[model samples]
Target chain A: MTLTAKSITKNYKTRRRQVSVIYDGDITAKSGELTVISGRSGSGKTTLLSILGGLTKPSGGSVFYDENDIYSMSDDKLSRYRNAEIGFVPQGQGALSALTVFENLILPASLSGSKAKDRAEKLLERLGLSQLRDAYPRELSGGELRRLSVARALINSPSVIFADEPTNDLDDENSELVLQLLKEQAQGGAAVVIVSHEQAALKYADVTYRMDSGRLQREEK
Target chain B: MNINTLMLKNLIKRPLRTGVLVLTAALMTAAMFGGQAAAKSMRNGLDSLEQRLGADIIALPEEAQAKTDLENILLQGTPGYFYMNKQVADRIAAIDGVEKLSAQYFLVSANAECCTTKVQIIGFDEESDFTVKPWLKNTYSGRLGDNEILIGSELSTKVGSTLSLYGVECKTVGKLEETGTGLDTAVYATNETVQGLIKASQEKGIAVLSKHDPEEVISSVYIKVKDGFDINDVLSEINQTIDGVQAVRTKSMITGTADKLTVFSKGIGIVTIAACIISAVIMTAVFSALAGGRRREFAVLRTVGFSRKRLSSLVLSESFTVCLAGALLGLFLAGVAVFPFGRVIEKSTGLPYLSPDIGAAAGYAAFAAVAVILTGALSSAWAAYRLSHADTGSILREGD
Candidate 1:
């Protein structure tokens, strides 16, 4: 089933006052589609994605997938959904510094109780990361690290892959490689969500939306 | 494969820091276990001595006691307990309801080097000695021949297995079964043997030794009341009837002995508890620092769809693994540490000269280790929870 965020609202608290971040929004990404969310800094792209992924509680409204209000489920169920069904390539600090490249890439499968050895090796070879399998995150080039992050997000073979700026620090070659990989995941019947400000990523989106002023604006797809 | 194993590996990635923590915990455990062993042995020895002495009513000259007679004996050979003339034994025995009395002139022989231990010597006459004989019914099993004596089992095991008391060789043929009485480490002898030592000391010009005619000399006297007689009444009657005599009953000595042991045990207990506290604080501090240092990694786990609960499990599991390792290692090192000390204890205090009690040492270490592990786990758990809740926006930028 496709995921939809309908009028999801959120607030950020400071000592002075609580400020509304995501006022209200209706955004949907169907199966086998690449949905790109681009916005300027502080426009709440991450907050919007967090609500869609059930990573944080929204101040108001609800998120739905196949007509089920995800906010109504228990915290544990939400966590299991995140672990077994959704893949997230988090922004900064994506790599577990202590783990090797292979271990970091396979962490999601490990956490979800899935055997990931073959998948991990396959991903490493596919991403041109086989040579650096044993290297720590600190030893990798920026582009290599970003590719590892994408590999980690795909380890569990989730129905939905949410990547936040999967190619933020990569060169044109690595950037193109990462975008093509996400498009391939969408083409393979997985819903792909990309949160990035990188204009180079727009060419690969099946459907794209703009997050402006903490609101998702529909654009021609 | 589980979150626990993954977390443990991450926590122990810095092997040097983890090793240091485990070693500290082991040392703390050993100190705790060792100190407890020492005090336990001491108390066991004292209790045996109490049962062995067997004086129901102890008549000491009252005015000069600084501490209880038992404490005085434990510390300084009971000399602070004033020595009244032996005449009080007969007079107290003359009181109504007093069935028997015996006198024993005991000396804390500092200069007398007997085999391995220079200990207290009590001089008792053969007749009217109900106190020593009753305890001897069970403990004093060896034949009392010239230079033939029964050294305490603890003492017997030491110093060639036979004692040289007052320059006379006495074979310790048997050890008292576990009486748990205070006299477990004492040496017993006849009035003649002790008198001869006194005479020999006098010949050496130790004139400060309390003057007592070899015929009637004794340190303190023991009294037994007739059947159906009130012990308190006999005690007061002895006080009223006998001059220069203070008659104390069994209750006094029991309380006195228990109190002395409590004081010593508490001292050792304080030290053990302090070690536990220090270890816990150190473990917590080290773990907290480790957790803080790994905040980025934990945040990364959160982003990978590992829940806060999973993160917490990983952190606590790491702490548990360390505590278990430390406890087991501590036990091994403790066994090694106590080997020589155990022999000394078995020889001097006679608890038993066997292997260290694993159950006992583990029991003590468990008390401290569990608490410390929990403390460490709590710190790590808190840090992981906070990291999970931290704003992922900044970390995402950093990850990028």
Candidate 2:
């Protein structure tokens, strides 16, 4: 399966003036490939990922998953798609403070009425969070919390994955672990997209793009 | 975790906020339930009093013209006495519009060394009595013998018990039905039996008992007008013809009581409505603030593929649970205050007060529960909408 964004544009309207954030930005991710979009702050890399993840409605664009346009689907249908097919590991402390580590791991599958307990346990064991399964987000270290978010994104075995700054606030070893996990997901025939500035993530990318001034350019590998 | 589990954890994690919401709901339900119960009790009391008062007109001695005193004597069982000649009954009976008439003698058991409790003693001529005898027949069908007394329903006396007054032992042969009036606290006997008590008192050197001759004086006369006779005209005729006595229409007394009840009911209604409004406003503000803090939490759920409708239902379900708990607590508190102290409330208000039956009280409780729950849901609706419709991407990136 392939996910493609064509001529996507986004604009923000303030009280005084309208500001353009993205202009004709485009990228594609194929099955069994790890795609990376690297950029500086305010380069609209997060906004592009949000649009491609079917979260934000682009000012003008169409995102096609294989043959289906995600934005054209009804709200419920799109929500179901996001739940069963797409996984998101957001930036900066994404685990719910109210839930334990194990609960956060199973939340995505639980939304679709499945327990996923065995899968959650295995993911916790793989992410080295088994000892802290019952601990809340506040009780976990920064790297531990980051791993929990990664473990949650993989619990449902989603066909497509989106990670925004997944290694933020993590040490070198933990960042390497998160990047290796994304590479393993791609090797297991999933389409994985990572938006980050970490230099180590470049080694795992099958295809890389650089975003600058709201424009995406293919990077020479 | 499941959605319900999430909702539960969210509330439990913030006990202080949840407690405030629950307490507000409790206050509202308590005010509403208490006010309605009080109003209903007063209305029931008035209905009971109307049924028990069998006479259309009452003629009392001129000295008993203090209306409040007469009302107190009739309604609260306060003992009082003002005597006119026994011939007053005969004169009232002779009036053209007077279909029937009976005289009553009243005595106070105050400071009586022989009696353990103070009570208003009513002596009715059973042959001429149209009012008290009918009520007396409810519990005792036989003729009331000399020295045989019937106690009011409010008195803690059994049918076979005996009462001693003025050194005379009166056998308690029966009990009267509840009237929700002062009459429920009185003691009733044959006129001859009461005359015996008076003689016993005077012989014992009770100087106050000697002031009035029991055989020659009567306390009040109850008058029933004939069918098809204008009651107002008959009342005017009795008042104009009678000497040293005043005749009052019972309708006027009922109207007066009803006016007071209307005011009392209005006051209760106003207070209940104000409480409801205040609670609703506070709840709305509280829920809004809570939602403001939980914006990202809700966005996280949305990111995990929860539909807007599910988010809304989660908020409403939390509020429903809290309000249901509050409603039950409020009903319990109101029941504790209103049911056991019914008599005290009645006496304090100086109006008739009869508690609603258990079934009716339960129905009121159910209505209050449902109303309170609905109010809570409505109050949380704005918060639910805001949380569900928030921009998920923006909220997730708020502090980034």
Candidate 3:
């Protein structure tokens, strides 16, 4: 499935004034490709990613998954769609602190009412997190926690993966590992969208875009 | 993981907070359960007292009324010996509205060779008695013989044991049901045996009665008024027509005890209300703080496809588990307070409180459990609503 966002806008009502975060943002991510969005802090890159992933509603636009408008579905249907079709990897410290590494990895599949033990074991082995299965988030280092979060996002084998700064708190070695995993997910015929400002992430992107003042500009690679 | 497992993990991670929540719930339930049990027991005690009295009015010699407290003699088992003219019963029986009348003879045995213990000996006329004989009908086929006696339930000796009263060994024939009153320490016999005891006491140099005339003396007369007759009018008539005698309505006799119970019940009610209010407020505050602290966790769950309703269910399940555990703990604590320590409560409160019936106690426990759970639910519902309605993007951004 191809994920498309058209003329999306987001506005926030602060106590002092109304702030517009995004304006007329357009982006697309197709299966078998890694789409990377780079921007400075507070440049609406995270906001755009949130709208495309159906985690937040756009004030004045629509997101479409293939032929279906995502926002038009009922809340319950949208939730199920997210559960079965989309995966999200948020920024730093995303793993639930109360759950162990293994429990956190299987959370998405658990929510979808599917068995995930085999898939979780495979992901843990692949991410080198097999030894930390019973370790809580507090016991994990920054890099291990990031890998656990990514493993959770991939547990359902979702059609589209939206990862927002997944390597924000990781060292150089762990960052490279997480980026390679995202690239592999895209190679396996899943749409992967990564939102970050890291220059190193650009090397692995099949298509890259830059955000400035809520506007998207394609950068020739 | 299932919702229950997730909820349990969330609680177990914060052991101190979970313990506080459980303790609060327990306190609320224990206060409610214990107060209700105590109040019910007191009510049952009052009912038992009313049933045992069975008489509308009691007429006794005016001098006897002054010498003996009627409540003490009949309610607390304090033995007393008093006598007035036996002709008073005939006079009260002739009074208008007097349906039935029975005269009883009272004698107290001293601590001597003639007595098994210091006990009250009540003599009933077999032909004219209505109070003691009806209770004995279920055990004995005919009237009590001269040597046979009926003992109170609290008496140390069982049936078939011979009780020596005033130098006369009377065979125990039956035991009366417990009334939780002074009557439990008394002994009942035929008037012939009572007369024999009186003669024996005088011959043994133990003059129990101040009067020497046994044939013409009576202690107290119990009267039952006919239906539709005003009891106050009967009381007034008996007091005015009978000389050297005073009449008391049995209902008026329990006013003091009933008032004490009412005050105690009201005190418990006030305490329960205060505890409910305090627990509700504390639980609300705690849930609100918990929701606020876990904003990012909820947002993450929502992003992973948990609907707002499902999120709310997670919170409710956590609250339900805590409250249910607290309720069970509270019930156990209440059982400890009521069953094994009932006498201590009675002595401290200065109220006659019997142990509540098991069925009634179980019902109260169920009520308390439900009430505690509902309290927890109500306290957590607003927090859950606010959290579920929060924007997922904002909550996720909160971690930044």
Q: Among the candidates, what TM-score does chain A have in each?
A: 0.95, 0.97, 0.97
Candidate 2 chain A weakest lDDT stretch, 10 residues:
A89-98
Model 1 misplaced regions, further than 4 Å: A138-143, B14-53, B61-71, B75-87, B108-112, B124-142, B156-160, B177-185, B196-215, B226-233, B244-296, B315-400
Off by over 4 Å in 3: B63-68, B73-87, B105-123, B133-138, B145-172, B178-218, B339-344, B354-360
**Cα distance off (Å), candidate 1, residue B373:** 5.6
Q: Who is ahead in TM-score, 2 or 3?
A: 2
Candidate of highest lDDT: 3
Question: For candidate 3 chain A, which ten residues in a row score worst on lDDT?
Answer: A89-98
Per-residue alpha-carbon lDDT of candidate 1 for residues B1-400, written as tens digits (9 for 90 to 100): 4544675666467688879777766766666666666666555555554555565677777664622654445323323223566677767767888777788766555444663445666656666666554554344444465544444444545422566544555555444443333344556667777666666667756633555665565677777778899999989887777767677886576575567657766876897788777877788678778766776676667667666666677777777777767766876676566655654654453232233256765676576566556655664566666666665444554433
Q: Which ten residues in a row have the lowest lDDT in candidate 1 chain B?
A: B73-82
True contacts kept of each: 0.46, 0.51, 0.58
Instruction: Using TM-score, rank the candidates from best to worst.
Output: 2, 3, 1
lDDT of each: 0.69, 0.85, 0.85
lDDT leaderboard ranking: 3, 2, 1
Docking model 1 quality class = acceptable
Q: Provide i-RMS per model in Å.
A: 2.4, 1.4, 1.2
- Itemize residue pairs with steric clashes in candidate 3: B75-B182, B77-B182
